[model samples]
Target: MKSIKTKHRIIKAVSALTALVLASGMLAGCGGSSDKDSEGRTIISVGSWPPEESDALTAMNERKARFEEANPDVVIEPDEWAFDRQTFYAKAAGGQLPTVYLSGFTEMPEIINSGYSSDITEALKNNGLEGMFNENIMDIISRDGKIYAFPTMSYVLGLAYNVDAFEAAGLMKEDGTPMQPANWDEMVDFAVKIKEATGKPGIVLPTADRSGGWIFSAIAWSFGVEFMEKGEDGKWQAKFDSPEAAQALQFIKDLKWKYDLLPASTIINAEDWYRSFAVGDGAMTVVAGDYPRRVAKYGMTPDQSGIMAIPAGPAKHVTLLGGEVMCIKNDATPDQIDASVRWLKTRYNNELTDEYKTNTETTTENAKKDGQLVGIQSLSPWSDKAESLVWYRDYIEQNANCNLNHVKLYNDFVADCPAEIKPEEPVC
Candidate 1:
């Protein structure tokens, strides 16, 4: 696994200073009341980065309208802001951060330790959602038994393959089920067969950006390698300079050079990789479970898409855990904080309410209308396996446009594999 550096250096320095100033201001009752509009409605801004004409943007707008209707005292504000390492400090220091924003799970520890996030322990308890979160996820955003953020969604990295390509390559069992490789050698063989059968790259790898390192880490972890580890002195150190790590990198190199199974353009990122895979230009790619929606947008049907656990390595099978955590800004007023919690609960926790049911139906219908993927399988942030399956069973059976069978292999793996948190970047 490759060690990824901290994406934003300024976050570590500025957040602590900002927190101190805000904490002092709070004692003077000076920082909390500035978030109200002239109409006296509490303004709650949400951060997102959907393109103007995208289905994601449309869905976000619809959700905002529903949230406002349910809470008359609050006004929803949409900020077309995406998290970028270069610009995050500027936005945060300039008081431009939205009341609620999406942050990567990898960033939560630093964000929490720096005091940039609001402590939402009380809020979760007050809303009766304290015990509902998946413990593995909650542990990432919590410190000293206090949670600073909400787990919005979590996903495991897996092999997303073209079902048609697999079948054409005769990579299916006698019963007509896709064959899942148990180790790297089998995976390589399958890739070669698929590429020979279909004149396309056997697999697409992200090698141009940090995602390259991210994906590499999952592959290495499966081979029992860690990018960094805490030492006996209680300080983190890089451990990737080892034989196991070398073997992992060599495997990727072999896929490109030795096996000739990868594309000549080796610098593709997520967008480019998705474009190729969705259009049937590649046999498979390692991606998160949330990729189905993007696949759908590219005109791939559920039957054409298949997902499975990342093939096991010599040591064990593992998948990388990734997701977004919802956070409130540090300087938000108590009223704003309360409002944020209520909004989260309305969206995630009140699944049994009529309002939520109506919203779900509307969302499903709109997704169908927009040709978006509905009921894609993913890790639930709010419930355990048994509860999550039961909680969304009706919605899945009724509105899913994708073939659930394509995702069954992944679902079964997640049901048993113990999820490990992404490794924190090593500090020099």
Candidate 2:
């Protein structure tokens, strides 16, 4: 029996909206190039790749085109850089910076420290898109209580299963959807039943060290890690060594030892882990914000594969919040910031622009057919539709899941990575 207990606590979106409005006035005008012309184009550079074939790179190029179409006078240039967490700052330095660009939410500190990006308060105000992002995440990017970035994805970490694997394991739902196990015990039972039925490992256990760390953090959090809380001294305290964290770590240790259902080589790298998934080593695996689309391309369509959140635990049902956020350059001139806002609002809220937006990037815009969980708390769009870019407003109206809270606690996890691995090359 999956005995994990989960209680959901969602932060109110109203508070976020309230904060955003108040925040816009704080950084009313950014300082940047004063040039202004209806015919003038602000060169917005982005990290992109080409000539060398890469799926992710292709996706970026497709979106770049759509942005140009929507803002006829803006030139969105490719700010090519390695996708590693390190190189982004280097690119941000060379003055090769775009008026605006995408970046990781947690990494905002680096940007703030460097003073490369514009403070987005005014742009967010002009478009009325402020504070709509996950509140906690907004807190993460904020310094001295001012907003700097716009959170875009509301992703929930969940299981993505192989339909063929399920059929082979006799685990399909009566509705013919692939079985998506909900909590931990159910997950283990399903894994065992499948392996017994098919002689293959039941869960691949995403062995890549850092990736596994991501899953492990969610598990520990679901198991109840009292992360980031005001300490007795009233400072943010790190709690990775807590009992709950240890238990979570032990659970992972058990999966590797007692479960005996995962292949060692599989844990070596993320690509290898996905390959095991593609070959149907199990009925299910932990899929991140981007992997469901990869699963769809594996053999069956996304609908056929079926998806659901991570297993519940005794403490809380939480998924490690991951993905990117778009922030403003703190140094950008007021005019440049406004121009960027015009483009951002069109892309962020414009209803008619999504399909064109998704199509250009080749991200799967239609992953929400079974619908999505767009928690105002979690903020970033749950877009596994790597090739789809339908307007987010339409998505939010139809499939938004209301319970997501961008739990500030889960942000401290550092992948306990092994030394043998190397990061894959960036697409752009």
Span of ten consecutive residues with least summed lDDT in model 1: 1-10
lDDT of 1 by residue, 1-428 (tens): 11123424445455666688787765353233367888898988777747588877877678778889888889877778877756665666545678988888887776776567898888878877767887667678888989899887788787888888898899865553578877789888898999889888888878867778778878888777867778899667888898888888899899999998887788888777788888887788888877776777788776687787778787677777777878999888887888898888776653466666666677668667766556556666766532433656567666677666666677666656643444334331
Model 2, span 173-211: residue lDDT tens? 555544545567788888887778778877776656666
The Cα error of candidate 2 at residue 345, in Å, is 3.1
Candidate 1: count the clashes: 0
TM-score for all models, in order of appearance = 0.81, 0.65
**lDDT of model number 1:** 0.75
lDDT of 2 at 154: 41
lDDT of each: 0.75, 0.53
Residue-pair clashes per candidate? 0, 40
